[model samples]
Target: MLRKIIHIDMDAFYASIEQRDNPEYRGKPVAVGYGGKRGVVAAASYEARQYGVHSAMASVTALRKCPHLIFVMPRFEVYKTVSNQIMQIFREYTDKVEPLSLDEAFLDVTENKKVMEFATQIAKEIKQKIHCQTRLTASAGVSYNKFLAKIASDYNKPNGLYVITPEKAEKFLEKLGIEKFFGVGRVTAHRMHELGIRNGFDLKQHSEKELVHHFGKAGALYHQFARGIDEREVESEYVRKSLGAEETFAEDLHELVDLLRALDDIAREVHRRAEKRGFLAKTVTLKIKYADFAVVTRSRTVVNYLRTYDQLFDIGKELLLQVDDIEERKIRLMGLTLKNAGTDQVVLTNQPLQLTLEFKE
Candidate 1:
């Protein structure tokens, strides 16, 4: 059976909310984030984006791009309330609604409660309901599957709706850039470009076997995407395997003291989240990203569950010290994670021998 999928994404979510609440911010360049030397822009309004100010860009850089840009601190509690409002609207149509974030979700409406024959109509109604309840706008994409639906949602953005039928999928994909494909990041896009695969048509020229030889498991996915095919389901329930917190620094830290300080903050955050969720884990992992974008992680599994901030910090410190030549490399990011013991989830670490010690009663 052909499944009807709809992907909905809010327009400049945080920034838009700020504008809606504050009339003075309307029609002006607004950024939602802390405006400090070390802060980063979490969201940029359309007006700010016109000035080349965008999310994740340095706060100082954003100021340089748009001198009149107004910065507003994020109100996460209010955002969560709005998220619940939109999710309720989604539930009215179908139960198979998968939320990707606070502002975006995918809905499988093949068998809907409204008995609507057209997916496009459902997308339109959902968008209307969201705006009516939240005074906010959303963009929606409707298609036969998830991949094309997600792409279609972005095609006409900022209070827009787009539909990609089965007949138009292949031709549309052939004209799409490789970078526009799902899961194709900067590094992968560069490699694809080097291999003369700049667009979907170029990607289609290679056989599945040839693609797999060049890109491994992801290559198989690329081949299918190029042919406008994706079999992945809309998973309504998401199972979290680990709890972690990470921070990207405004300036690289080269000193051990600075790294330890950052690690302490991250450890506290992970512990607080774990306690709130009632998540218990026996393993602690320390992750580091260098200035050159090389990532490395080290993990330690203890005899008992990690239940204290002190225990998390101690294990993270130990793992950090085991890293090779840490002083020689400038660290750009630091993170701490607590993983559930006895899970098959892959962990990238420097430890060669992983031994599990157990006591027999």
Candidate 2:
């Protein structure tokens, strides 16, 4: 049976919230983040986007692009409150809701509580309720699967609704650029372009085996996506396998001292999240991304669950030191992750085993 999925994404969530609370910021270009030298934009208003200012862009660069851009600090508590309100609205229609972030989620409404025959109607009602309650606009997409629904949500922005029916899915994907495909990041897109795979049609020309040879495991996903087929289901109860936090710097750090300082911040963030969720793990993983986009990771499993910030930071430092020729690389991003030890034990126990027969051989 075809699933009825709806993806809801708020338009410029933080920035819009700022504009709604402060009328002075309504018509002007606004950015939500710190305005310091190393600060990055967390969100940008539509007005700021016109000046090429976007989220994750450096604050200094954003100011250079639009000198009049106003910066507002994020109010996460208020955002969470609004998120809860919207999520409650989603539950009124369907219990199968998967939140991607505070501002976006996917809902499986094939068997909706409202018993609505049309997914589009549910999407419109959800958007209307969000506007009435929060005074903020959201964009919604209705389709038969998660991938197409997400894409459709972004088709029109800032209080927009779009639907991609089963009949329209193929043509919609065929003309879509490879860069717009989910999971095709900058590195993968460049490789695909080199292989003459610029769009969905180009991608469909390659077989699954050919794609896998060039792109590894993700190649199979691309092949399926090109045909407008995704078998992934909407998981309502998400089980987190790991908890981690990462930060990207506006300027690359070359010195060990600077890297350690950045690692301290990331470690604290991971610890805070772990404590908040009551999550315990026996493995610590450190991820480093160099200025040139090369990435490396080091991990260590301990006998005991990590329960303190000191433990996390110490393990992360040891992992950092294990990297070869670290001084030669300019680091742009650093992250720390914690994995549950029991999960590994379960995998080992489930593995199939073969017995050797020396006499038969």
TM-score of each: 0.88, 0.86
Query: lDDT per prediction?
Result: 0.86, 0.86
Tens-place lDDT digits, model 1, residues 150-249: 9999998889999999999999999999988999999999999989999999999999999899899999999999988999888776545677888878
10 residues in a row with least lDDT, candidate 1: 352-361
Rate residue 39 of model 2 by lDDT: 73
TM-score, cand. 1: 0.88
lDDT per residue as tens, model 2, 1-361: 8999999999998899999999999989999988877677889999999999999898999999999999997787787778888888999999888887788989999999999999999999999999999999999999999999999999999799999999999999999999989999999999999999999999999999999999999999999999888889887765556778788776789899988988888888788877876677899988898988799999999998888999999999999999998888899878888886454222211111111100100
Model 1 RMSD vs true structure? 7.4
